[model samples]
Target: MEKAGSPLEQVRSSIAQACKRARREPGDITLVAVSKRHTAATIEPLLIEGHRHFGENRVQEAAEKWPALREAHPAVQLHLVGQLQSNKAEEAAALFDVIHSLDRPSLVKALAKAFDKTGRRVPCFVQVDVGDEPQKGGCPVSDLPALLTQARESDIPLAGLMCLPPAEIEPAPFFAFLDKLARDHGLEGRSMGMSGDYETAIMLGATHVRVGTALFGERPS
Candidate 1:
C-alpha cells in the first residue's frame, strides 16, 4: 500500500540528510550521477527529473550518445570520470564540460592543448591514488604536488583533487586525508565519494560525489 520513492528522490533525500549531519548546505555538493555503461533511454528519467550533472567513463561511449542527449536536455553538464588517454585529449576536452581523472603530466599537457584549440576551459579534478593500488587510475599520493604544478603551468583549470579509496575497507580515513590534501594545496573542490561511501565523503568535505548504482541501479550483465 505505501509507494516506494523513486531512486532520484531517495538519493536526494540521503544527500540532504548527509549534508544536515555534516552541517553543510546541500547546494554546496554537486551530485554527479554517473551514467557510465547505461544507455540514453536509461538516463532520460533522471534528466526529466531535473538532474543535469552526469558522468561517463569512456570517450567513445559518451560520443555515441551524449550529443543527442544534450540537444534534448540542453543544460546537462557532462563529466569525464574515467582514465583518459592523452591521444583522446582533444575529443575529451571538446565533449566533456568537466573532467575528473586528470592524473599525469602528459594528460595535462594534452588537455591544455585541447582546451586552447577548443577555446573551452573545462575544469578538472586531479585524481590521486590514495590507496596506492597499482591497477587503479589515479596518480600516487606523492606525485600530486608535482602534478598540480604541471597542471597550473599548462593552464589547466584545476577544480581540485579526487580519489578512489581501496574497496572492502573503511573509507572515512581516506576521505579525511583527501580533504587535508585539498586544503594543503588551497583547492576548493574535492571530487571524492561515490555510491557506497558518499555519506562518509560528504561528512569529510567532498564538494562533488560521483554516484551511479545508487541513483540508476546496477548495470545489466
Candidate 2:
C-alpha cells in the first residue's frame, strides 16, 4: 500500500494531480474535509493549514462541535453530508452551509419550511442515485429532471448534484454523468466522490470533494 503524507501535503498533492489530469486549475475545486467521527483536536491542524471547508454527517454532533470551532476559525464553512431526517431540518438548516443529501421531496419541503422560518436560504445539492444502490438515499436518475424542475421553481436555490458511486465501479463515469446532468439542467455545482476517489471526481468536474480518511486518517472504531 502507498504511504500517506501529512493531511495538508496530501491534499495539496492530490489537488495538483487532479488538476493536471482534469486540465483545470487546482483552485477550481473545493476540498470539503469530512470530519465525521473526528474530534476537534484532529481538525485543528487542518484548519490552521488553511482548509476552510469541513463536512459532517450528524447534525447533533456537528452542532456540538462547530460553535467552538467557529470561535477558533471564524471563516470555516461547514457542510452536512449525510442523510438528514426531517425532524432535524431546522438544526441542519442553521448549521450547514450546504446540505449534500437532499433526496426526497418531503426533505425539500421540510428544508423550505425551515428556511422560511429562519429567513435563510440554505443552499442544497440534490443527490442522484447513479448507482441505484438499494442502501443509498437519492433521487433515481429518471426522476432527476422532474426533481430539478421542482427545485428550480422553489426558493430553495438548488446549487447542484451529488452522488455515491457503486463500490466496485470506477467513479469517473458516474462523476462525468453527474457533470452532464448538471450542465443539462443549468446547475452550477457538483459534489461527489470521497477520499478514495476524489481525484477521479475532480477530473470529472466535481466542484466539491468530500475527503475524510485521506485527510484526517481513518475514523477511530
Candidate 3:
C-alpha cells in the first residue's frame, strides 16, 4: 500500500498520464482532491505539493474542516460536491468556490439568497440524474433545461453540469451526455468522473475530476 505522500505523487502521475492519453494539455483538466474523510493534517502535504483545489462531500463536515486550512492555504479552491441542503446553503456559499450538486430549485433559491446576502456570485453546477436513481438527488435529464433556465434567471453563476452514473453502467456515456448538455446549454465546466472512472471521464471531456481514494487511499473508517 502507498503512504499518503506516495499516494499524492501517484495521483499527480495519473493526472499526467490521463491528460497525455486524452491528448490534452496537463493543465487542461483540474484535479479536485476529494478531502472528505481526511483530516487537515493529511491534506497539508498535498498543499505543500501545490495542489490548490479540494472537494468535500458534506456541508457540515467541510464547514468544520476548511476554515483553518483556508487561512493557512489561502490559495486553495474549495468545492462542495455533496448533496446540499437548503438550510446549509448560506454556509456553503460562503466557503466553496464552486458548488457541484445543485439538484433542486429550493436549493438554488437558498443559494441565490445566500449570494444576495453575501453579495457574491457563487458558481454552481446543476446535478443531472442520468440514471434516475430514486435515492439520488438531482434534476432529471428531462427537467434540466428548465433548471438551467431557472439558474440563469437567478443570481447564481451557472458554470456547468455534474452527475453520478448508474452503478452498473460504464461512466463514459454518462459523462459524454453531460458534455453535450453543457454545450447545448452554453455552459463551460463539466464536473464528472471520480476515483474509479476518471480516465473515461477525461476521454469524454471532463474539465474537472473529483478524486478521493485514488489520491488519498481508502477512507479511514
Candidate 4:
C-alpha cells in the first residue's frame, strides 16, 4: 500500500479518477463511509474533513454512537447500510437519514408504520439479491417487483436499489445488472460498490458507494 496524504484524501482521489473514466462528475457519486464498527474518535477526523455521509450497520450501534456526533456535526447525514430488523423499524426510521437495506415486504410494512408514527420519511434503497446468495439480506430478483409495489403502496420513499455481489468473483457483471435493474424500475440511485470495486461500480452507474476499509482502514478483529 502506498503512504501518501490521508486515507480520506486517497479515497477521494480514487473516486475522482473513477468518475473521470466513467465521464461522470465526482460530485454525482455519494461516498458513504461505512462506520459500523468504528468509534466516534475514529470517525471524527472524516467529520472534521467535511465528510457528511456515513453508514452504520445496526440501529442500536448508530443510536448509541451518532446522537453526540450529530449534535456536533449537525450537517451529517447518517445511512443505515445493514440488515434491519422489522421490530427495529421505528428506531431505524428515526435514526437513519437514509436506508440501504429495505429488502422485503415485512420490513416495508414496518418502515411504513414507523414513518407514519414519526412523520419522517427516509429514502430507502431496496436491497436486491443480485448474486442470488442465500446468506445475504436482499429481496430475490423474482420477488423484487412485488416487494417494490408493497413498499410504494406503504408510502416508503424509494431511493433506488442496493446489492452485495458474491465475494471473490468478478463484480462488474453484478454491478451492471444492478444498474439495469434501476433503469428498469425508473430509479436513479444505484447503491452498489465498495472498497475493492467501487471504480467498476462507478463505470456501471453506481450513484452511491459504501466504502469502509479504503477510508478508515481495516477494522480490528
Would you estimate the TM-scores of all the predictions? Answer: 0.97, 0.94, 0.94, 0.97
Number of backbone-clashing residue pairs for each candidate, in the order shown: 0, 0, 0, 0
What global local distance difference test value does model 2 have? Answer: 0.87
Candidate 2, which segments miss by more than 4 Å at Cα? 1-5
Every model: Cα RMSD to truth: 2.2, 3.0, 2.4, 2.3
* The candidate that achieves the highest lDDT relative to the unseen native structure: 4
| Per-residue alpha-carbon lDDT of candidate 2 for residues 82-161, written as tens digits (9 for 90 to 100) | 99999999989888888999888788788888998888888899999998884788899998887777776667878799
Tens digits of lDDT, candidate 3, 3-88: 45476777767778888888987688888999999998988878877789999999889889989998998999999988998999
The residue-level lDDT of candidate 3 at 89 comes to 89
Please report the TM-score between candidate 2 and the true structure. Answer: 0.94
1 or 2, greater by lDDT: 1
lDDT of 4 by residue, 28-99 (tens): 999999998899999999988888999999999999999999999999999999999999999998999999
Model 1's alpha-carbon lDDT is 0.93
Off by over 4 Å in 4: 1-4
The whole-model C-alpha lDDT of candidate 4 against the native structure comes to 0.94
